[model samples]
Target chain A: MEIKETFGLMARHTDDVIVVCALGMSANEWWQVTGSEDTFYMHGAMGFASSFALGLAVAMPDKQVWIIDGDGSLCMNLGTLLTASGQGPANLKHFVLNNGVYQTVGGVPMTGASRSSYTAIAAGAGVERCYTADSMNALSAVLADIKKPGHCFIDLQVERDDGPILAPPQPFEGPEMKYRFGRAMERRFGIEVFGPEGY
Target chain B: MSNPTVHDQLVAALKRCDVGLAASLPDDWITPTLQRLDREPGIAHIRVAREAEAVAAASGAFFAGARSVAVMGATGLFTCLGELATLNLRHQIPLFMLVSERGSRDDHRIYQEVQGRRIKPVLESLDFPYFRITSTADIEELPHAYEWCRMQKRPVIGFLARKLLKG
Candidate 1:
């Protein structure tokens, strides 16, 4: 099972409330895998997917929220791991594809990056438990262990490199999507998007 | 007796750094601090929809030649984690984070404590340094923290004690 296949299976299980944010290389693979133009937010701004996922999870507790991230990307926002742990959102699942390098930016080797033990970091951050996988079978088995009413952090150790991949051509939808998102969040969280007066 | 209130000390410390943009989402605890920050004409305080959005906006502001910071609660810090690590850490961008302390074991609410204690450890795991402040006495170090961030080209966080904010 390729990484893309893994995403497809996860997508099938996700409902409308589940929000996905893909960053860096994973974003490149994910936009294609899900073919979900709107389902994922290709945060051109790296390291923010987890944070955004947290917001969506808190706002829509009933929905299953997913984050497709890269090791380099996750390392950049490593603080988020701890933050996410503390939030303890049962419906959120964080999948980090660790290629042992910044695969998106020239595939440069990250110093002691892989040896950094993200699983330990996740567990220490209060994730309860975390899983790591390189092959699809392992991934499916670990993902199966992710029970509901808890957060799952999966660190996927993939090949050090993937061939050339292009970002989605369609520019990310503008403020309109934000408005819709805000409305949906407001409905779920019962808080106005921009407060009582609206922004 | 102190010459300035805790709020005044914070404002002075921020002013000393010549901070331009103060971005945040409103919280009852930090409302007074936000209002005080707004009073400084030298600082432009902008309210963002989300805590992470404020961090991103601050990143943009820094690139555009502005020194900026975002105000948020301890829990809001969790929400802004991606930006704190990515834009701020990966790119070596400096965005000051002023977070309100909450969810300690003694706190009145059970709201976000489950995850609140994890904030410090998260910062540690990320290898980012932060300063925890409890009163006006700590104002003198703001410039040093700001300068170090300038030199290192990364984000530095300042956690304000709950009592200080309550006052």
Candidate 2:
């Protein structure tokens, strides 16, 4: 499946789920598809979007959290799989866009991309429900199961392209992004993400 | 305050700061504190495989309106510079980290010497602010430090010295 198609499927499935996107292609494509202020588009922190999503899931046990990760980012901090499994937040879903290349960096091949099985690796790391979807039909078939309550992992095997399809960046950056996301959380969940004085 | 143990005092301090969640990786000096956190009733303790996971996890908790902390040794802190810079610094996420002062003169471990000597200079280069806690009295400042971290909107380190942890 193409990368955009995978994102399109995900966008359709996103029903009040707070998304955290890994930096680069995953974040860019997610922004293009959703244009969501509620989602966090990571500007840096190449490998830990999964960890960040894990934190959010653990904090808000009632809310569903999803991480849109990339092959290169996942390889950079594979230990995140173990941590996520250990926490085992029932509200978290980890999704990897596996194109076998760093599309944002001009399509450099990722390390061990062809041979590495992220689903198997996640299963080994103690994630009980792991799936791989290489085509749109396969992905569509698993969409309901992916949204279920549990620590789940999905490897979306997308076709690699030479360059990242340019998309508009997140409208906010740095502290502005923090405030917007935090405020959105507060409004959605009626939680106090910031103090009375707005720190 | 009546606990007399450093671990208990630190844990109590964290509670005073309203920290509901803690993400931690073990360092010998901080192990006692981590153990206490694990057993604490109100705090959600998460044990992570890497220091960066702890850092990023704590950052994530912040957006959920949950006050959180990350605990690790000095060397572990060194391993997470990229995450600290990109995740915490780049996003201006306030993360509170309790790191053991591993390379101090009293620590005496040769392996930790580099972390002791270089960590501060690197933090300086990154323009990250840190505070050193050396005595029981200093534990009281934790709440203030945590609030300051939120106000600053960046990762802040509270360095726990060997002398303090050993007390």
DockQ-based CAPRI category assigned to the predicted complex of candidate 1: incorrect
Pick by DockQ: which candidate is best? 2
Score candidate 1 by TM-score against the native.
Answer: 0.54
- Candidate 2, clashing residue pairs? none
True contacts kept of each: 0.05, 0.88
- Weakest ten-residue segment in model 2 chain B by summed lDDT: B1-10
Clashing pairs in 1: A76-B85, A86-B115
Which lDDT tens digits does candidate 2 get at residues A21-46? 99888888888877878888888888
| Candidate 1, B54-112: lDDT as tens digits | 67656544422456677888888887676676556654556677888777655577786
Candidate 2: tens digits of C-alpha lDDT, residues B1-167: 36458898899999999999999999999999999998889899989999999998999999988999999999999999988998788878889999999999898889999999999999999989999999888998899999999988888999999988885
Against the true two-chain complex, what DockQ does each candidate achieve?
0.07, 0.84
